[model samples]
Target: MPTVSMLDHLVLTVADLQATIRFYEDILGMRAVSFEPADGSTRWALSFGAQKINLHPADGPFDPKAALPAPGSADLCFLSDRDLDEWRQHLQAHEIRIEEGPVRRTGATGPILSLYLRDPDGNLIEVSNALHS
Candidate 1:
């Protein structure tokens, strides 16, 4: 059996692709890259670190999409190097409200401090950093 190495990408069904792109680009500091699929339609994806989220228009479904496709139904967590305070400041500067806060959570790596917020499409977003002694 082949084991999973890493998550290459994920798909996000968005109501407004441009708005979702802007939120990730301006707030999360991600870069949006556009590509043409086999259908010859232009699609965009937000790139950060080594991962990317493919943006699919809610009305336009690719070859294979989620059975229950709904916008704002995703809950994603991102690993960060910034501490809670710095993350708080950055969110505030962008005028984004925090749904929940610097709470204790165990991530894939280990213990982490997480802060939660909502994206433009109301998708839950968590930013966390490793907790060290």
Candidate 2:
């Protein structure tokens, strides 16, 4: 069987694409990039590091979509270079509540110190710092 090595991107079905874009871009510091598809339709994506999250309107038609593409259903973990303390301060300054953590968790890369929060659509977002040097 063929194996895939990395995740290129993931799609998020949002009630308000613009609002989702704003939150990801402004709070997470991800860049929003626009593209014109072959059909001359425009789409937006949030770019960060080597990966991106594609945004789709919740009511819009999308092929190969999830059976239930609700906005708050996803639980995603993001790797952050900032230390746990800095993450706490930054989140507080932005008025975003930390739901849980700065606790130890096993990440894809091993041990991580994580902080959890919810996005505008209530998706559980975990930002973590690798505990290993």
Candidate 3:
């Protein structure tokens, strides 16, 4: 049996593609790498270093409140540890909400600081840096 190695990407359907792209780019610092146009609409891809996040416009009328992910549920975590204070300032400057302990030490591994936040789509994302091996 082949074992699962790692996540490839995440696809989120949003009401506004541009707004979502902006959130990822401006707030998360991901780069808007590419987009595909089909039938007058488009699908876009954003990159955080090597990770890819794909965005597609919602197909029809939908309720955002009903579609949001449950609290405490996360779709992904983008690990980083470089200059966490700067990251916090960046989020605060943009009025983006953040969870507690962007500064906690990991119990399972060496010291690491983590910051958690949600995307426009309510997907949980984490940034952390490993302090040791």
Global lDDT scores for all candidate models: 0.91, 0.88, 0.69
| Residue pairs with backbone atoms closer than 3 Å in model 2 (clashes) | none
TM-score top scorer? 1
Q: How should the candidates be ordered by lDDT, best one leading?
A: 1, 2, 3
- Estimate, for each residue in 1-133, the C-alpha lDDT of model 3 and write its tens digit: 8999777876666667778788888987788876554545444788876678666556542233236524223456566646788888888999988875666656345677788888776777777777765
**Superior candidate under TM-score, 1 versus 2:** 1
lDDT score for residue 60 of model 1: 84
Candidate 1, residues 1-133, lDDT tens digits: the string is 8999889999999999889989999888899999998889888999999899999889886768999988999999998887779889989999999989889899887898899999988899999989985
Clashes of each: 0, 0, 4
Candidate 3 displacement at residue 128 in angstroms:
1.5
- Identify the superior model by TM-score, candidate 2 or candidate 3: 2
- Higher-lDDT candidate of 1 and 3: 1
Provide the RMSD of all predictions against the true structure, rounded to 1 decimal: 1.1, 1.3, 4.9
